[model samples]
Target: MNNITKEITPLTQNDCFTIFSRVKKEFNFPLHFHEEYELNLILNAKGAKRIVGDNVEEIEDMELVLVGPNLSHVWLTHNCKSEEIREVTIQWHKDFLDEKMLKRNQLSFIRRMFDRSTKGILFPRETAQLVYKRLLVIDQMQGFDSVLELMSILHQLSTAKSMRVLSDATFNNDQVLNYHSRRIDKAFEYMNANFHKPVALKDLAKLVNMTEVSFSRFIKRRTGTTFIDSLNEIRLGHATRMLIETTHSIAEVSFNCGFNNISNFNRFFKKKKNCTPKEFRENFSGTRVFI
Candidate 1:
């Protein structure tokens, strides 16, 4: 991504956060990312296309999502026919809450939610409805009260049920690695670095000084996926970047990303993104405007 725009938001040093409320006919903003965590609520925008990292989906009438800092995201008008689309966006700097404060017992749920936001968290419609009232008037509050209100909103969202993560976990490069096991961490570190080449589970097991069957069980228990699937996820992450950043052919990108052939690449890409590589690239075309 060279084409993905980097948005320099209006949030200043003196502000805890910035809120933008607007009613528009359609979405026209380009795909972009910024150095601020964002909570966006959209109403009456059914059929609109939402792209968060490598995840693309059609939105419902009411939508709420929390996107982490520097994650590429955008909403396109697409098939939406609504003449009035209501949107409320709240953005805060990453450091707005101290790391120490986030670790406190009272803030445990919020802290976990923040960590999951790196992949973009999609709040359910029920939660969205419950909190939309507060979000609408939060900008009207003053000083410390406003800060407290924002924190309250986040805490509520953190405990909501059925919150889905929109993007692939590996799509964000800044995600922290904390499998909480030394062997698991080492295995993943090796997998990430060597994703462009052919990988074998036997080799990884040996590298981690464990037998193949034992290593497989350990990795699955810790990471919740098989070794081959994890390797493919890493390869797909790099492939998505190449698809967005380069003009290379699909077969070339597949090979360069360590997939043996185009069909396998297409299968994995569609399995993860619900679209072929070509379509994924085209989604980023035409309407992207940078300034």
Candidate 2:
């Protein structure tokens, strides 16, 4: 990650949300994060690279994603050559939805969806097609009615099927680590705390009171990734932050993140970020967008 910018969104403290719609020739925003939650819709941008946390993918012609507060993301022009691109962005404060309101029976589904958005959520094509028109018109309406309409859109999206989580579960430190199991929580807590040191599956299994083999299976089932992969993700997350906030040498960053060797660290970092650590730092040092 380059010195990823932190965007101060236009939503005032008193506003429920803000929407921006545009027809543009290209995507130019820098990789950035914000304190507000964002729902962004883009059309005619196939081949554009979408980066959300540690996940990066070439977007389709039509795409929609919900990015949680402070999660790094950006859409780059890449191979997208479309002269007419349509984009709609909606941003809201973190406290826009009351905690108690989200817990209600009518809003439980939205609550769970919001929780998953911490990693960024990619709506399927069908859902994106269904919601894009609504998003486009949302800014035109005013007052309390517009807020209700936005809620309606979220409700529809919440119930939509097959929305995929786009980033690693442990990529964001502030993300709630809830696996609904005490053992899983404990294991992750330990991993996050000691990710900068040598850690092994056997040690983690013992800490969670399980045999090595059983612990491996349990973690795989709970997080959909093996123990080693999960640990690597944690290390990579910290490494990204360090890259942005520190002037340490690339070798230092690699070693301090617990990678035993520079080669292995470079391999993993490139695989996750699509660029070398040095390239990432240089990119961030050049230009940035405050939007």
Candidate 3:
């Protein structure tokens, strides 16, 4: 999918964060990413397809997620019958937390949460329901009160026990490695661009000026996965999206996602998603056009 870059500006003058609440009949946003950290809550959006980096899943009635800087994500209406979809979004700059402040004892949990969010973070439904009221009130608050409430909500989320990290390990690993080496960044860019075709370890190693043996170990150490596994994750991400958003047949989806055979695609997709392509598509109630 082609993802667009979105610019997020503060809602108020001199404010470091922005919060928005809207009720719409349809979700029309394109697949996109932004530089700011984003906290999004959706209500009455059951069966919506959520894409975060290399992760793709269908959401239930209510959903809450935190996406880190530049992580591609979007919620597309798939099987929602609700006439009204309520969404609340809060965005803040990554630099909002100063280095010294993040190291404080009291902020350790929040810091850890932020680190985990380099991939997308999905909070439990119960936790989302508990925080829903406060999120609704945030739009009505002003000045310091609004900021304080937002902080409190984040603190509560940081301490919540039931949460899952979306996106594949390789995606998060790329983010981490990019901070330490430019070579890794280039390697990731190449992989993302060419995942539909064959990728050779020898070529990647040459790009990084390492022997194939050394490159294999380097990939495993840096991404916590082998090169083949990372490639599969990227392909699966695309395949899953197509399964949910398009009317493609299983064979077509698999082929388009770079798998050479139907059987191999079925096996890998099942291993990753715990369901067959047909079953995954059947789970959706209906599809709606974006307004």
Q: What shift in Å separates residue 45 of candidate 1 from its native position after superposition?
A: 0.3
* TM-score of structure candidate 1: 0.60
Alpha-carbon runs more than 4 Å astray in model 2? 173-291
Tens digits of per-residue lDDT for model 2 on 23-92? 8788877787866789999999999999999999999999999999778899999999999888888888
- On a 0 to 1 TM-score scale, where does candidate 2 land against the true structure? 0.60
- Scored against the true structure, residue 181 in model 3 reaches a CA lDDT of 57
Give lDDT tens digits, candidate 1, residues 218-289: 888776678998788778867876776589999999998899978988987876665688987876442211
Residue 208 displacement in candidate 1 (angstroms): 42
Per-candidate TM equals: 0.60, 0.60, 0.58
Give Cα distance to truth, residue 53, candidate 2, Å.
0.7
Best by lDDT: 1
Assess the local accuracy of residue 169 in candidate 3 as a C-alpha lDDT between 0 and 100.
52
Preferred candidate (TM-score higher): 1 or 3: 1
Residue pairs in clash, model 3: none
lDDT per residue for candidate 3 within 218-285, as digits (tens), equals: 77777666888767776776676677668889998888878888999898877666567788777634
